[model samples]
Target chain A: MSRKLSYREAMREAMHEALANDPRVFLMGEDVGRYGGTYAFSKGFLDEFGPERIRDTPLSELGFVGAAIGAALGGMRPIVEVMTVNFSLLALDQIVNTAAALRHMSGGQFSVPLVIRMATGAGRQLAAQHSHSLEGWYAHIPGIKVLAPATIEDARGMLAPALADPDPVVIFEHAGLFNIEGDLPDDWSADIRSARVRRQGKDVAIITHGGSLPKALAAAQTLAEQGIEAEVLDLRVLRPLDSESIAAAVAKCRRVVVVDEGWRSGSLAAEVMARIMESAFYELDAPVVRVCSEEVPIPYAKHLEDAALPQPEKIVAAVKEMMG
Target chain B: MTDHHAAAPPSGPVPWDKAFALRLLTDMLRIRRMEEKSAELYGAGKIRGFLHLYIGEEATAVGALHALAPDDNIVATYREHGHALVRGMEMGSIMAEMYGKHEGCARGHGGSMHLFDARTRLYGGNAIVGGGLPLAVGLALASKMQHEQRITACFFGDGAVAEGAFHESLNLAALWKLPVLFCCENNLYGMGTALERSESQTDLCAKAASYNMPALRADGMDIVAVHEASKQALRTLRESAGPVFVEYQTYRFRAHSMFDAELYRQKAEIEEWKTRGPIHTFTARLKAEGKLTEEEFLAIDAAANEEVAAAVAFAEAGTWEPVDDLLKDVMTPPPPAPRPGGGDAGSPPAAAPCEG
Candidate 1:
């Protein structure tokens, strides 16, 4: 029995459930214990799970993240939350070299089974250092699963399967979706391998994930007002991207517009476009156009931040462009 | 402190017998010969890419590895030809890996710096400084959690001590009382930078002690001393108290890599260290004790040369992986399910009972 909850509440519930159910599962990150997480995601978890499980780590991304990987390899289910994707750069070596490569490098003898969660995307006037979506970079690596839990159901469900997976899984929780509320049905079980179609349509397919999903859906609404029905596909699993579902959507819609919060050059949207070209090129009515963040560091000012990110209006424009 | 050189030798010639000593010497010599050949191969452009040789540090790996059981896991740095050789990985496969051939232990994916053998429980040839330390800690953690009687021996250079992974691994190992042997080869130089210039506290043992773990130092050039220290450390670690740190004061007889100009240290310095090389010093000690003669030493050298020659031939005959199957081993292939009636059923009958 699930109720409508915000993305932040959904994630907090997932952590709370994991801690309550699994004795070995623990949460460690900056401000996750006492300060209730940087975005107030784990507000009262310290009191509930105690300091041991809901740990507050020092501002050592490389140190703590590497320790989390070690702890995972040590037979503990550790969920390490890096405050932002920008800060995750400090721990990239551990993530890419150790967690992602260990299973394959060890000749399938070991698996890390770690879950690294971080808030990505830029739109809150957080400036350059605090903002940036690098999920595309993580998605490029093999032997690791990449997930973008954009919906409330996914925010609630992704953690369990991620913990169950043998290999390492990196979950990108966009900062913008934290406060957005959505319905969580009673039988909401999220699959880590398929893309969920948030809205059904026939004119065009709006392929997006993470923070861009809401914008894509909103743009679809705007597109519906203009008599062009757009289907919104939220790519939950980003790494072994559900290409079959994407191909099916492309084959049905005949036109596609990808909206991603990452930069335009070499983004996950580019990978999706390439997949469409490889699998469903003949079914396309027009060339796939992408509405990605401008190739620049996210700005601090509200207007520039909005301009630098993929906004609903921009996604609508891209859909209209694809339609013509 | 009284000099222990004249002290009574342990009852009946210590723990190592003649066969074990000979095997240790053979292992060191094998690494020495293989590395020498690899250097020659590098010069001739047969083996490309970065090659960090473990020439003078052979005793540190050979002696320390001999102290560990076959079930124990080993994680080593990029300069791990010695570790891989002593860890019981096939010499031909390791050489083939360095040659980037499909017959390599890692199937040609990881070359000189990344040789891995799962059968021997050798974790990696990790190139990142202090990278293997945490992995060793984790392996030990797994053993501790699973109640397995195994210790993980991690080898890294003095340069890796400066990395955060080193500190974090030490703290975690101590905090958890994990059975990990942190073997730091204090070669005194990190690529071009020396230990004195890089570290504020040059005493590596003191740093390990700060984490509340047992720490010791040994003359890495002396193979017997390295063996005794490592054996004691491994014994303590296997008992599951906590991690132990052994700082082997060693030196590199050659350039850091083939491309290194070696402007960081002096030529005469290398010549001075070469005087106390592990191979010669240990051979001299064995001869003095009547355990080895000049002819026996020549035989060991000849055996190492033959082994290396055979490895080179194997690598030369090794093939390259086909480009079409580049994506293999990225993930483990799902195992084939068992048939319903216990017979081999191709692709499993559609209505058959699901057997994992």
Candidate 2:
């Protein structure tokens, strides 16, 4: 049983289910209530769940994020929606320091069962301040689990396990995926771990996640038309990264090109490439390559922004280069 | 700029009954004695890491914590040995925590700046200047959402008021009307930086008032004043949907930490604040009122010293956590078996990490 849903609707359904199912679950963030959500993923949620669950918080990221951590510790499951990855920097101290460190620092007596969701990536032309992708920066931290839901199934699936796990989880929703429509399976068995092969082939593996997923798929299609088979791998879980899947992809297709919307210098693509070398070096036919955002602040102009990000043509070029 | 001086003599008689007055005096003595011993231990190299002594700020923790119910949550700053002790963490755990022993409340991992105990509902001795405020706000939000009648007490220094977290938390707690008692221990300086040097708005109560919360100022060197102020504030919080602010105007009698050079202030400055030391002034007040005799005072002093000594021995006898288990608490122990009402949802259904 499958039903068509926009990625945004799938996410909203997941949140609605989480709220209706758990008495302790509530949503709080800026404009989540009245303004429907910065992305409209939470439109009509307040009317459905009322003000108690769909809380509108003051513009205080550190305050609310930390408070969410506390609420988690105090026996409420809080889903904190930081408006964007740009604004999440203000709450990074709380997210990285307090929420992540509390369980370990408290010697296992406390765990922050908090889920923080924020829009990430640069396709929105929102410029450097609002459109940067920093999920890799969050993925760098050890205390919390990071998930980038690239597909409608992932958008439908990741939240339940994230909430069920007794630790802090950050879900990064790419600003580009909200309107994309796809079918969601009734039985969503997606866990908050492992990568999935969106398109299987034998010639090369294209590794990517979040907003880069569609571009990688497009690149794979172009490669297919040119008779160069490509396997597209979507890294759904960023932290506690499913290196095994990366190895499996490598074992199947010896060469890999990681496409990421973040910058080339110290990006999640770099981590993936490093892991591929570490785990599947012997299997590689050529050195692993990457197509990442240019190493500069994302510019405001459309052509420059597209050039700065990982695009379908760039992915095709990178993989074609890797395949040779 | 005004020169530093001790707070004036506390006015009026001991408002509390004799027994209660003696208990307050006893708690201040306990903190003062424990801190003195901790300083001595640091000299002996028994306790390492940042040791922030709450020596002169005893009245703030003892008085404010005494006003809260046992089940309430307490979030304290790094300089919170007094807060933990007054909140009923065994003195032994506190000492062992300072010594970095496994038997310590946080299993020795927290050191001096991160003492945490689940049983006492002590959230932490949060080291960041204004870090604990948001957590306190959340805990208060939890209580409010759950319809629990408990309040959350958050303690921080004057330096924290300058932090964005302090302002943000104040606004959130006030805007949401969460029941959080924000206790600002204005001990003149944050580490070496004096309050006046850092904050343009020196009046902390006015800052809290800007958040639309009622703010009260107390002489932190006077335990009775602190207790009275906290009680009044908490009463308002319980009656109204409030997040109250209490500024305990006090001073630290020692260097900010063991490593501090004390370069920011003069010796005369510390000497001036010591005259109004919580222990001595309270002792004098109790003595003048005949509520505490010199012999009885000596008994309390003797008891505190004995307790701190035993704590040091317990810490000395404590053992190290085997290095093999370093990653034990990094993630939670997996959740328990599901109830019949729930679906089995956790545990990533792929190859788990660290397993071959």
Candidate 3:
């Protein structure tokens, strides 16, 4: 049994389920209430959950995020929605310093069972200030879990396990995927741990996550038409980088291409390629290559923004180059 | 702005009965003695890192903490030895934490600036200037949502008033009508930057007033005034179910940290503030009111010394956490089986995502 839903609807369903099932759960963020969330993911949530549970916060990221951390400590499951990953920098101190370090700093005495959701990646012409893919920066932290839900099923299912986890979890919902519609299986629950192979092939492995997953999948389709078959490995969980799955994919395909929306230097693609070298160095037929965003502030013009991001054409070209 | 030089010595009666009064005094003395011992230990290389002494600010923590119920939560700043002590954290554990020992309150992970005790409902010994405010607001938010009858007390220095977190947290608490007692221990300097130099509006009460909350100022040097003001603030906070802000005007006698060279202020100013020293003035008032005898004062001082000595002994005996267990608490261990929708473990694979 399956249903069709957009990524926005899927995420809304996940949040609604969480709020309905847990009395301790609440959602607070800028425009989460009457404005219905910046992405319209929580449109009717305010009416359903009421004011106390569906809190509309002022543009105080540090305050609300820290308050969410405190609420989690006080035994409430709080999901804070920062409008975009670009603005999350305002609350970075609370998220990185306090929420991530609390349990360890408190000597295992406290764990922040908090989930922070933010829009990431760029497809629209939202300029430098609004468009950022800093999930890799968060993935670098030790005490928190970083997840990028790229598929409709993942958008619907990942929230449950993230809220259930005892530590802080950051879910980056690709801004481009919210409007994309897909089939949602009746069984939509997903693990917040492993990487899933989206498409199976033997010639080359295309490793990516979040907004780039669909591009990788589309590129694989394009590659298959030309005599080269590419495997699409969606890294659902970014932080504890499902190294096992990555290594398996690398070992199976021997040649690899990593796709990341972040800039080339110190990118998640960089980390994935390094992990492949560490775990499956001997299995490589060629050196791993990556298709990453150009090292410039994402531009406002449509063409420039597209140029700054990884596209299906770029992914296919990278795969073909690796296959050769 | 408060004129520290012109302020009169804290006088007048302590209304509480002998036992309660003595307990408050003992709490203050405990902080003073413990910190003094900690200073000596720091010199001996026993306690490393930044050692911020709460020597003169003891009255604020002791008096304000007494106004709170045992179940109420506490969030304090880096100069929080007094707050932690007054909130009932074990002196031994506090010293052990400063010593970086396994038996410390935070098991040596958090040092003096981050003494967290779950047993006492003390949220943290936060080092960031305005960091604790939002956490306190959240704690109150949780309590209000859960229908719990407890308020959270947050302590920060005057310097924190200038941070964005301070303004944002105050607005949030007031907007939500959360039950939190915003205790601002206005101890003249924030690491040698005087409050007047940092803040555009030095009147912290005005800052709170701008948030539309009832703001009060207390003589932080006077334990009685601090207690009375805090009691009034907490009372209003509980009755109204809204936040209240109290600015405890105080001073820090010691340098900002062990590394500071005491270059910012004049020695005459320190001497002037010393006359209004919380312990001496309060003891003098107790003598004038015939509430305390000289022998009783000596005994109390002796007892505090003994306690400090015992805490030092405990910290000395406390062991270092093994290097093998360094990565123990970075994350909570995952459950045996993955939690499904809404955290029900065995909810069947019906909700599991289908393989694409």
Best by lDDT: 3
Q: Write the per-residue lDDT of candidate 3 for residues A1-324, one digit (tens) a residue.
A: 888999999899889988988888899999999999998989999999999999999999999999999898887889999999999999998988899998889888878889999999888999999889999999999999999999988988889888878889999999999899999877666888899999999999999999999899889898899978888999999989999999999889999999999999999999998888888999999999999999999999999999999999998887777666
lDDT of 2 at A270: 92
Error of 2 at A313 (Å): 1.2
Model 1, CA-based lDDT: 0.83
iRMSD per prediction, in order = 9.4, 6.8, 8.2
Off by over 4 Å in 2: B1-10, B335-356
Residue B248, candidate 1: C-alpha displacement in angstroms: 1.0
Encode model 3's per-residue lDDT on B1-356: one tens digit a residue.
Answer: 21223323235577899999989989999999999999999999999999999889899999999988999999998898888888888899999999999999989999999988888888888887899999999989989888989889999999899899999999999999999999999989988888889888887888898888888888999999889888878777767779989988899999999999999999999999999999999999888899999999999999999999999999999999999999889998776865455324332222211100
TM-score of each: 0.86, 0.95, 0.96
Q: Write the per-residue lDDT of candidate 2 for residues B84-151, one digit (tens) a residue.
A: 99999999999988898888888877888998988889999898889999999999988998899889
Is candidate 2 or 3 superior in lDDT? Answer: 3
Winner by TM-score: 3
Question: If ranked by TM-score, best first, what sequence of candidates would result?
Answer: 3, 2, 1
Lowest summed lDDT across 10 adjacent residues in model 2 chain A is found at: A184-193
TM-score preference between candidates 2 and 3, better one:
3
lDDT of 3 at B335: 64
The fraction of reference interface contacts (C-alpha pairs within 8 A across chains A and B) present in each candidate is: 0.22, 0.56, 0.52
